[model samples]
Target: MKKNNINDNDIILEDLQPSHAIHLYEMMQDDRIYTYIPENAPAAVETLKEKYKMFSKGSLRKEEVWLNYAIYLSSEKLYIGTLQATVQLDKRIISIAYILDPKKWGAGYAKKALSIMLQNSKEQFGHFDYYAYIDTRNERSINLVKSLGFKCVEYIENADYFKGSSSNEFVYAKISNK
Candidate 1:
């Protein structure tokens, strides 16, 4: 589990726990979430809990770490989304990802959560270059990363086959000055 509790007043990101499985699973049931993602929602709450349990063990090795956080709204007392980041210390890179409930899209929650995650990652993982791989058809995600200063560096065609068709992706990177 994560030790840091990151927040920007309006939203807070805490360590993702098995307890969050139920609420998150409910949100994940929305098929729109899987449009660009290669994986479907957890088949069951138990499945998601088991996954979260493994996630709680933290990284097993020194060169890489998987960081996952659950986004919470204290005012509304609800779980709204999640943040996932892979810190590849050996490669000096960080891959950041996030998912928000479909009902909550366009509310700026993701931007705030991601901004906070990137800021915290700087302290935890140093100045590694940050990256995001988004499906070409995901315009909102593309615009979000661009607004955060990420520049598209590569276009990958037929990156993966999911939901019955092949997908092309844009590799966006926020290069570190260091």
Candidate 2:
């Protein structure tokens, strides 16, 4: 794959790098950010290293299906968060996921990163639709996606919650290319 620079008024989407590990780890340590995300554990230096190694190997695999991006502040070049998309090759659809640093939550970085991912996915993978699975109680994230024109299509009741509490899973979708 190729790396392309995605610039917005305040943030940039760059190709993921080993150098971003520390910043990502620090961001993931915030309980607010990792609370709803089940797959993301508390990010430690060692965990970051292992994840980077695994991602490297996964990227090289012929059957690998995910694309990951690192989000940064364009002005200060600070790593802010991550965006990931998985392609369903058979269905020609892409599912998107992202997490922004809790420190920067109200600043619109997540929306910018998501817009870039949607555009890039259309250009590179010919994906016309974008989908996301978000916890219903994550009002910020749900609002963010809705603000981007994603419509909530359905809700899966009592979905798998990371913590002990039951949480509704909302499925949101948007047409990106067509």
The best candidate in terms of TM-score:
1
- Residues 90-156, candidate 2, lDDT per residue (tens digit)? 6766788887889899887788789877877777877457889999888998999999999999999
Q: What is the lDDT of residue 141 in candidate 2?
A: 88
Residue 10 deviation, candidate 2, in Å?
3.7
> Distance (Å) between predicted and true CA of 82, model 1?
0.8
Would you give me the overall lDDT of model 1?
Answer: 0.90
Off by over 4 Å in 1: none
Per-candidate TM-score against the hidden true structure: 0.95, 0.87
